[model samples]
Target: MATWPRREYFYYFTKMMPTGFTLTVDLDVTATKEWLAARDLKFNAAYLYLVSKVIAQTPEFRVYRDNTGQLQRFDVIHPAYSVMHADDHSISSLWTAYDPDFTQFYQNYLADLAEYGDQRTPMPKAPQSENTYMIGSIPWTHFTSYTPLPFTPLNTFFPVIQAGKFEQEAKRWQMPLSLTIHHAVADGYHVSQFFEQLQLAFDHPEAWLAS
Candidate 1:
């Protein structure tokens, strides 16, 4: 805490003046979609896996405070997302433990989806872990920008990621990606780096996605 680099900045943002920002960018996912389609994989699951992998690899996105009110960073962050029910369009919140291996994580995601995807309850399918962050998708529409309004204060530093509907533009498939992050834990530079890595992952699915 005393030697932490962003201690003062964190205090200023969390206590003095809370601030958070949301940035939405278009990601080229043409190759990713093609890769998934060839294998008959769900786009939503693949997108979530990529985003979770990026976040877990970035330390700035994994910062959180413990129960004793001490700031800390998780070694990895899991994805907590909503599953829509077909009957009334209600959503069920679910989370899965993140695995570095794509195959393992995808299997875990399928297992959770199978057991709890249809449940209309607000409770998560599995016990939500403290190291988890929110990730979601809006496949029905495309948008340039989106903001998330969480009940917690601005210091809730873990990022919330959302992907909009993908559309074909010229020769590429582009999707809107909105990222909301706490300023206390990261800066615009860190955000840019995260997006760069994310886009790289999208462009090179063969690198991470198990064939």
Candidate 2:
């Protein structure tokens, strides 16, 4: 623990009353959406792909302690997101294993969506992957602020991501994205770094979205 960069912050925050905070920002996704539209790709899958790619590259988001009480960083973190069922207006949790290769990951996402997207059960994939984090969308509303609280707060440290409806202005599309993070694992600076990279990814779809 001596050389761990977040040692002090982790201890201080987790020992306090509240240990996490959520920040929402509007990200311009004009180029990304255009690219997806041209390719006839699902925006939700692409969003999860881009977001998880950035999360894997950011070390702070990958930090967690193991069952043995040893601090460890996951080599990659997968996305466990919500899939809405059109039939009965229900939502089920689905997860796709993270693959750094965008093509492979997108294919995996499509396969999962095809199989379990319409399932009647709440959690089709029960006992989700240990190295997965939450990512979902609220397509019905464009929320300016959102907070997602875990039932067992201190027991989790992974980041929770939520996206709101995207609306286009004169020349650009803006999507409200909220990121909830444990203060022990990250601060505003770290969160800003992640958002900055994410915005860049959204702005330049050709960089990583090309098939």
Candidate 1: which pairs clash? none
> Candidate 2, residues 1-211: lDDT per residue as tens digits?
6899778888888776457889999999999999999989889888999999999888889877777877788888899998877777888899999887788999999988888887878778666788999899998889999998577634447799999999888889999999999888899998999999999999999988876
Superposed by TM-score, candidate 2 places the C-alpha of residue 21 at a distance from the truth, in angstroms, of: 1.1
Compute the lDDT for candidate 2: 0.88
Q: Estimate each model's TM-score.
A: 0.96, 0.95
Winning model by lDDT: 2
- For TM-score, the strongest prediction is 1
lDDT score, residue 86, model 1?
A: 83
lDDT of 1 by residue, 1-211 (tens): 7999888998897779888899999999999999999999888778888998888888889987777778788888888998988879999889988888888888999999988888879865656677778899998999999999888453347998998998999989999999999888988988899999999999999997874
Q: Which stretches of candidate 1 lie over 4 Å from their true place?
A: 154-156
Error of 1 at 185 (Å): 0.3
Residue 103 C-alpha lDDT in model 2? 87
Clash totals for all candidate models? 0, 0
